[model samples]
Target: MSLEIKEQSEVSPFLSDAARSAAIDNKEKEIKDAQHENDDIMCGFWIFKGPLLQRFATETMYVTIYGVSGCFMAMCFAYFSGTITTLEKRYKIPTKTLGIISVGNDMTTMFGSALIGYYLRKVHRPRWMGIGLFTIVIFCLLNCSLHFIYGAGEDALKLTREFGDLQNITGNLTGSHKDQKLCMSEESTCMQENSIWGPQLILFGAQFILGIGQALFIVIGLAYMDDNTTKSKTPAMLSFSTFLRMLGPAVGYSLASVCLRWYIDPTTEPLIKPEDPRWLGAYWIGWLILAAITFLIACLMTLFPKELPSTRARRLKCEKDDIQNPMDQQMDLSLSGMWCSLKHLATNKVYVYNTFASILYFFGYMVYWIFTPKYIETQYQQSASMATMATGTVALGFSAGGVLLSGYIVSKYQPSARSMAAWNAIVDFLTVAGILCYVVIGCEGSDKLSSMAVTSADSCSASCHCEYVHYAPICSPNNDTYISACHAGCTDNTKDQLGRTLYTGCQCIAPSNSTSVPELQYAVDGPCHVDCFNQFLIFLAVMCFLKLVGASSKSTNLLIALRCIPPEEKSFALGVGSMVASLLGFIPSPIFYGWLIDKYCLVWGKTCSNKGNCWLYDTQALR
Candidate 1:
C-alpha cells in the first residue's frame, strides 16, 4: 500500500487535479454525444425531418393527435350503434343478423391484433398509425357508399296494388287506400328478390376494415405515446385521452340524432315524419363527416417522425442502463421463440386466470354496450335518436368520472395487490347486482305491440286481412290501441283543425264518455301513450351506477396481469390477453344477445318468403 501511494504521489505532481477532472468530464460528454448520434441515425425515412419542423415534434403534439384519433374511433363506433335501428328498418335486417354483423370488427381484431403487436414492435409507429387511420377512412367511405348503392328507401305511403277480382272493389273500401303504411287484406308478395345479403356483407366488410384500424390504434398508438412521454406523466395523459374518448360518444350520438331527423334522401319530403317507426333517416351523413376528419388525422400522423429526438436519447440511455443489470434475456423474434413465449405465457397461472376473468367480464358487459340503444327505444317506446343521445351522454359521463376517480384513488393509496383484487371482486359483485336491477326496472311494452297468436283481427276487422299491415299504430279515445286505422275498422277519415288525421265510424273504438255519439267514436294517428318515464329514469340511474362501479376496476385486471409476468413479456401478455378476450367474449357476446333479442320478436316483417326485420317485440320476454 505504501509503495502504491508513493507512486501515485510522484505521478500526481506531473498533472494537476483540476486538469485531470476536466479530461474525464470531456470523455464522458463525447461518449454521450456519440450514443445520441447513433440513435438519431436509426430513424428511417420520415417527413418533416428538418430542424424547423423537428422543433414542433414534441410528445405533447403526439398525445394530442393520439387523443383525437381515439376520439374519432369512439365516434365511429357510437355513430354506428346510434343508427343501428334505422339501418335495420332500411335494409330489412333481423336483429340477429345485425348482431353477427356487429362482431365482424371484433372477429378481425381477434385474429389480427396479436400478429400486429408482435411483428410491428420495431416499425415506424406513427406512420403505421397513419396507415391504419387511412384504412379507417376507407371504411367510413364504404359504409357511406351503402346509402348511395341502395338509393333512397321505398316510400312508406305507396299503395299495394291488388290485381285479379278484388282490385277495384278493395281499392275503394277505405278513404285512405291500402298503402304500405296501413292495414290491408292482401297477402305480401316478393316484388323482386331483395338480396339483403349484398348489403349485409358490405357492412360486415366495413366493420372488418374498422377492426384493422382499431388494432393499430391499440397496439401501436398507445405504445408510441408511452415511449415518448415521461413515465410519471403518462397516467394523467391517458386519463385525459379517455375523457376525450368519452366525449366522443356524446358528440357522435348527438350528431346522429340531428341527422336522423332529416329524411333519408334529404332533398325530398317524406310521407312519414322522423317520429314514425317506419322512418329511415339520413344515417350516412355522419359517416361522411367522420371520413373527412379521419383523413385529416391521417395526414397529421404521417408528419410525425419515427421517434422524437428527446425520447430517442432517453431510450438509448435506458438501454445502456439495462445492459448493466439485465433481468431477462432479449426477445427472439424467431418462429420457435414465438412459440416458446406463447407457451410460457400460457403457463402463468395468474395471467391465464385473469384473462379468463376478463373474457367473462366482457361477455356480460358487451351486450349492454351494443344493444342498450335498441333496448331503451323498444322498452320505453322512445324515439331511436332520443334514446341514443340520452344514454350516450349520461352513461359516458359517469364512466369517465369513474375511471378518473379510480386512477386517483390508486395513485394516492398505493394499494397492495391483494387489496386491488378484493376491490375488483367487490366491483364485479356490484355490477352483477346492477344487472339484476335492470332486469326488474323495465316498463310495460306499447299496448299496440301486444302480440296475438292469431291475426290481429276481431269481428270488427276480420274482413280486412290486417295481415299485410305495416306498423302504423292508432290510439282510440278509450285508450285501446289498434295496429292501424284500417284495423280499427274506421270507415272514414278527416283532417282535424290541427292538421291531425282523425278517424271516425270506427267499430273498434269505444267512446271515452257515454254522452258521445256512437258514430263519432274517434282514434288518433299514433300509439297510445305508454307511461314509462318513471321506469326509464330508474333504468338510467341503475345504468349510470353500474358504469361507474364497473369502470372503477378497468385497470385492475391489466395491472394484475402485468405484475404476474416478466417485464420484457408484459407487452406480449397484453396482446395475448386482448386476443383471448375478443375471441371468447366480444366476438360472440353481441351475436348471442342478438339471438336472444330475436327470440322475443313478435311481428317479423315479411320480405317475400323470408323473415325480415322485426316490426314488433314481445316486451315481456325481452325484459
Candidate 2:
C-alpha cells in the first residue's frame, strides 16, 4: 500500500515540470484561504468567549452530577434483587416471577440506550437533551409514587397487626375469602405483595429513560465540542472531556457514600420492610435532583451560539440563487467499508496485538468489577458502605496511577500511538499482578474485615462497622460446634468469646483462638477472591480501565491510519474506521462479558471444590 501510494504521488509530483509551478501556487493559495477563513470564525466567536469556560464548567458540573446519579440508580437497581428477595419473603411471591421482571428491565435498558443513540444523532442537541431529561423526570416521579404507595401499604399492615385488626384485614387487604385463606396458609397475600414489582418496573423504566439521557449527553456533548473547537484543538478538548467523564463517576460515588451515611440507617429494618425499598426513596431523590439539573443544563445548551448561521436562512438564500444542486452525500452505513477497515487494522500486526490485548484486559476487568465488591463484602463481611469504600480505594489507585503515569510518559517520551498501546498493555499486566495479590490474601484467610475497617475509617466515621463475617463450619480436635462466633467488638456485644482482637486505640475483639477458621481475605485474594455478587462491580472497573486504554490508543492509531491515505481519501478512511468499530467492536461487548463471568465462575468453583476445600467453593470465599 505504501509503495503504491508513493508511486502515484511521484507521478503526480509534476516531475515533468509544467504542472509543478501550478501545483505550488495552488497549495499556497489554499493555505492562505484556510488561514483567512479561520481568522473570520475566531473573531466572531470571541466577543463573548470569556464566559465560555464558565459555561463549560457549569455544563460539566451538571453532567457530572447527572452521571453520578445515573450510576447510583443503576447500582441501586442491580441491588434491587436483594430487595426482591426480602419482598418475596414478606409477600410470598414466587422468586422466579421476580427474576423475570429484573431480567426484563435490563433488556429494556439495553434497547433504550441504542435507541437514544440513534435519535441523538438524528435530532438537535438541545432537543435531545431536553427530551431525555424530561423522560427521566417523568419515570422517576412515577417510581417515587410507587415507593410511597408501597411504604403506605406496609405501614397499614403494621397498623392492622398493632391494633388487633388482623381478622378484618383479611377481607379488605386480600381480594376474596380464597385469597384470605391463601394468605393465611401461604402467608403471601398482603396488600403490598406486588409492591416490589411496581418499584422494580419503575426502576427499569427509569433506567431506560436515564440510559437515553446518558446517550444523548455523551453523543451531543462530543458533537458540540467537535463542532465548536478549532481542528487543531479538537483532540485535546475530546481528551479532556474523556478525562472529566471518567472522573465524574468517582466523584459521584464518593458523594453518594457520604449521603448514604448521613441519611441511611443500616441496623434498622428498611422503611418498606424489605431492605431494597429503603434505598428506593434515596435513589429517587438523587435522581430528581439530578433530573432538575439536567433540565437546567439542557436549557442552558440553547445559549451556546449556533456555530453556523441559521440553516433556514441559508436554504432560503440558496433557493434565491437557483444554484446547481450539490451531490446528495448520503451516509454510507455499509459492511464493505467496515470490512476494509478491519482488514487494514488486522494487517497492522501492532494494532492487531494491541486490540486483542485490550479485549483480554477488559474481559479480566469486567470480571473483577462484577465480583470484587461482593467478594469484599462477603469475604470480609463488611457493610455496603465499607465495600464501596474499598472499591473506591482501588479506583482511586487506578485514577492516580493513570493520571500520574500517563502524564509523565506523555511529557517525557512523547510516545507514538504504538508506544501508547504498548504502555497500556504493560498496565494490564501490572493489574494482573494486583489481582494476584488479592487472590493471595483470600487464600491466606487473613482479616479482610479489620483491614478494610482501618482503611475506611478515614473516609467513614469511627463508629461505622465495615466488617462482613461469614460463619463456616470449623473442624476441630474437640467435638464440632454447630456455630462458631468470630466477634469484632466495634460495637457493644451481647455475648463474649475468646479471639485475637486487633484495634486502633478502640475497644475491639476478634474471633477466639480458633485455628484454621474458614477465614477469607480480600487484599491477598486477587481477582480469584471476588465473590459472585461483586463480580459485576469488579468486571466493570477492570473493563473501564482496559477500555480507556484501548479507546485512547485506537483513536491515535486511527489518526495514523488516516495519514497513510491520500489527502482526498483521509475522510473516507476515517468513516470506514468508525463503521468498523461500531459494527464489529461494539456489538459483542456485553455478550463477551457475560460469557467470561459465567465461564470464570464455573472454572473457579470446580477447582475450589475438587481440591477438597468444599467450603472454599462458596462464592463469598473469592471476595
Candidate 3:
C-alpha cells in the first residue's frame, strides 16, 4: 500500500485551464434555459392564476350593480317628466312653460355629460360614480318636495275655479250679445293666465338636477364598463346595459300609475281636482320613495373598489411591454380636422344620404314616443296615470322587440358599414310611412259621438220660455252643447229667447214649449274622429320597428368602423363618433322640432277654447 501511494504522487499534476472553461460554459447555458422558463411562466395565466376568479367576480359585480343603477336613473327621469306633463295639463298651466322646463333639463344634461367626461379623465371613475349617485338622491328629494313648495292643491283650486266659472257661463250663453262678449272675454282671460312662473321655476330646477344626475351616471358608468371589459365585448355590453336601464322607466311609470289609482278618488269626476289633497301627497310619496332608492344606490357606490385592477402598476407595466400602445397617435384637436370631417360628411354622397336618412328616421321615432301619451289622454280621455302606464307598456314592447331583432339581424346579415347606411335609409322610408299614418289619424279626431244631450218635457213651460238644455256623456269630457227655442216669445233681439251653452258642466237646461216640436239635433259621430288609442298603438309598433332598425344599423356600422381601424385606434374612433352624434343627432333635433311645432300652431287657426276643449290641441303643439 505504501509503494502504490508513492507512485501516484509522482504522476499527479494540476488540470489544464481549457477543461475548467468548458465546465463554466455548461453552467452558464443551464442558467439561461432556466431563466427562459421563468419568463414563460410569468407571462402566462399561471403567474396570477389564484387571483383570476376573484378579479372576474369583482368586475361582473361592478358591471351589474352600475347597470341596474343606470336603469333606475333613466326610469326616474322619464317617469317623473311624463307624470309632470299630465299634472301641468290637469293644473291648466301653459304647455310652453313645460317646454322651457324640459329644455332647461336637456341643457343641464348636455353640460353634465361634458362635465362627467372631464371629471372621468381627471379623477378616479369610482369616485365620480359615487358623486353622481349622491347627486341623484338630492335631486329626487327636491322633486318630491316640489308639490308642497308650489302649493299644488291651492294652484289646482284656482285653475278649477276659473275654468269652472267659464264652463258655467259658456253653458248658459248660446247665441246672444252676452255670449259673444263672454267668448271674447274668456279667450282673453285664458291667454292672460297662461302660466304662473312659480311652479315652472320649481319644475325647471328639479329637471335640471335630474339631467345632471342622468348625464353623470350614464357617461361615467359606461366609461367605467368600457375600461373594465375586453374590447370585443364592449358593444354587446353597452347594448345590454341600455336594455336594463330602459326597464327602470317602465317599472317606475307602472308603479306611479298604481299609486295614482290607489290614492285617486273615483267619486270625483276629474281625478285631479282643486280640493283633492291626495294628489299632492301621492306624488310626494312616489318621488320620496325613488329618492330613498337613489340614496341607497349612492351608499352602494361607496363600496365600489377605489381603483381598477387593470390599471394597476404591475398590470400596466406588463401590458406596455407585451402589447403595442393602444393610443399612440395624439387626438387631432384642430379646427381644420373638424372642418375636414364635417366637409367629408356633408359632401360625400353616401355620407350625406345616410346622415339625412338617420335624421328623418330618428325624428319620426322620437315624435312617436314623445307625443303618444298626450294623444292617449286627448283621444281616450284616460287619466294621467293610465296614459303613463300605456306609454310605458308600449315602450317595453318596443324595447323587447328591438333587443331580439338586433341580435337576429346582426347574426344573419353580418353587415358592413356601407350596408348599415343602406339599412338606415330603408328604416327611414318605413318610419315615414308610419308617421304619415299617425298624423292622418291624429288630425281625423274621434270615432265616438261628438255630442249628447237630454231634456225632459216636464222641464219646459207654456210661456214659450224656450229653455235650452244639455247633458254630459260618459265618454267625451271636453264636448259642448247648445240649445235654442224658435217661438213667438223667442224674438231675435229679445231677452225672452231662452238660449244656453253647455261646456263640461254635464247638465244645463232652459225652459221651452211643452209641444215636442221639431228639436233640431246635431250629433257628430265617426271612427275617423275619436280613435287616438288605436293611432297610438300603431304609432308605438312602428316606432319600435324603426328604432330597432336604426339602432342595430348604427351599432353594426360602429363595429365595422372599429374593424377597419387598428385595435389601438378603436377607442378614439368611438369617442369621436359619440361626440359627433350627440351634437348632430340629439341637440339640434329637439330644438328644431320644438320650433317647428310652435310655428305650426301659430300658422294654423287653432285656438284653446272652453266650449270646444281646444286646449287639448293647444298642448299638442308643444309636442
Candidate 4:
C-alpha cells in the first residue's frame, strides 16, 4: 500500500506539468490567431465570404455618409445667406419681417424645443433623416416659382419710388426737409403695410422644411457617428465631417457669387453691372441641384447597418447606450422614458454651462454669417460677386481650417470639461475684438454721394423725386458718387452719344474743403474713388484673419455637452442644447442685427410696388 501511494504522488507532478504545458500551448495559439486576424485586416488577401458591400465598408464609411449629409446642408445654408439681400430686394421684406421669417424656419424645435430629439431617439435615425431630406427637396422645388408666381416686383419697386423711399429719407432727415419731401414723396398719414404673406409664406414654409432636414441630419447623423464609432476616433471623424460640411458652403457661395454676376436668365445680359445692388440671379437653381445630391446621400446613408455590428466590447458599450438614465438598464422606449432622460439632461450642470457658451458663440457667428456680405457690399461698395467671394473664402479657407485645427487639437489633448470652458472663453474674447473691428475698420461709405443724408442734405434734390427706383449711380464733378440722378438734384437727364445716362443741374456739386466755392454742376454714371480700394482690401483681410482666430476652439463643444450627460441621454442632451442655442441665439440674432443695420439706411429701394430695401447705407454708422 505504501509503494502504491508513492507511485501515485510521483505521477501527480507529471500530470500537473502536462496540464500547464497545454495551457501555455493554447495561449500561444490564441496569440497566433489574433495575429492572423490583424493580418487579414491589413493584407490584400482578406477575401470575404460575406455580403460583398458590407465586407468592404469600414466604420469610417458611416462617418463619410454623415459628412456627405452635412456637406449638402452647408451648401443650402450658404446659398440662403449669400442671396438674402437679393431676396429682400426682390420680396420687399423688412428687417423686422425678415427676422420673423427666419424664426419661422426653426419651428421644429419650437425654436429649440427638445421634442424632435426625443422623437428621433425612438425612430430609425437614417430613415427620419431621409424623410426630412425628401420633404426638403419637395419644398425647395416648390419655391422655384416663388418670385414669378407670387411676385409684385415692378409694382413694389414703383411703390417704394412713390412713397417708402421718401419715408425712409424724410424720417431720417430734419423737420424742414421731411416736410418738403413728404408732399412730393407721399401722403403724410400713409401707412406702409407689413409683409405681404404669399411670397413671405413661401419662404417661411420652404425654410421650415429645410429646418426639419437640418435638425434631423445634423443631430441624428452626429449621434449615429458617435454611437457607432469608438470614442477615440470620434473627434477626428467629426472634424473630417465638419470640414466637408464647411466645404459645401464654400462651393455654394462661390457658385452663387459667379451666378450673381449675370442676370436671372444667363442668356439675358444684365442691364446693370454686377456692382449695382439691384442685381439678381438664378438663386433657385442652386437649391434644385443640391437637393438632388442631398437626397442621394440620404438614401446611401441607409445602407450602413442600422446599428454597426460591434465587437464584444463595442457591443457592450452600445447595449449601455440603450440604457435609460438613473440606471444603466434597457431604455423604456416610452413617453415616460423620454421625459425622465430630458429632465436628467436639463439638470446636468456641465451640460447647462456648455450650452450657454455654445449659444453665445452661435449668436456671434450667426450675425457674422448673415451680415458679413452685406457689410462688405455697403462698407466698401463692392460688387455682390466680390463680396460673396470674399465671404466664401472665409467660410471655406479660414473657417474650415479653423474647425479642423480645433478638432485636431482636441483629439491630441482630449481636454477636460473645465479646460474646454476656458478655451471657449478665450476664443469668444478674441471674437469680440474681431467683431469690434466693424466699428472702425470700414471707410466712411461714399460721403460725397447724394445719398449721404448727413453730408448732402442740402444737395439732395426734391425735384427729381427718385421715381425710377433705378440705382444708376452717378459721380459728381467733384468726384463723389451720388446713388442716382435724383439724389444729385438733377432737374433733367440727357443721353450721351454713347447712350450712357447723364445728369445736369446738380445742386450738391460744391468742391469739398476747397478755398473758394467751385461750381461743378453735372454728373455721370459710375463711381469715383480717390484710390482707396487697396485700403479696403486690407481691412477685409484683417477682418477675415481675426474672425478666424476668434471662431476657432481648441476643444469640442459637442464633446463637452456629451460628456456632461449620462451615456443614455447624450442624443437628447444635444437636442436640448441645440434648441436652447436656437432659441436665444439663432432665432433672434438676425432680427436685432437687422435692426442695427436698419439704423444705417441712407436710401431705401422698393421691391416692385411695396416697401423694399435700404439701397444705400452709412458705412461709418454700421456699428
lDDT of 2 by residue, 50-160 (tens): 434334433334334333433433333333322232333232233233333333333433445433433334334544554554555555465455434555333223322
How does residue 335 of candidate 4 score in lDDT? 87
Residues 548-578, model 1: lDDT tens digits: 8887786555457656777556556666777
What local lDDT does model 4 show for residue 97?
68
The sequence of per-residue lDDT tens digits that candidate 4 reaches over residues 367-403 is 7776777777777777777777888865457878887
Q: How much is 74 displaced in model 3, in angstroms?
A: 1.5
Identify the superior model by TM-score, candidate 2 or candidate 4. Answer: 4
Residue-by-residue lDDT tens digits, candidate 3, 474-588? 2212232222221111222222223322122111222233433322121111111243566666656665665555445545543454454444333333333334444555555
Q: Pick the candidate with the highest TM-score.
A: 1
Candidate 2's displacement at residue 219, Å, is 3.4
Range of the 10 consecutive residues with the lowest summed lDDT in candidate 4 = 40-49
Best-performing candidate as measured by lDDT: 1
Candidate 4 Cα deviation (angstroms), residue 466? 4.3
CA shift of 184, model 1, Å: 5.4
Task: Point out where model 4 deviates above 4 Å.
Answer: 1-50, 111-113, 147-196, 311-313, 316-328, 333-336, 445-460, 463-470, 507-520, 526-532, 606-609
Pick by lDDT: 1 or 3, better one: 1
- Kindly provide the TM-score of model 1 when superposed on the true structure, using C-alpha atoms: 0.84
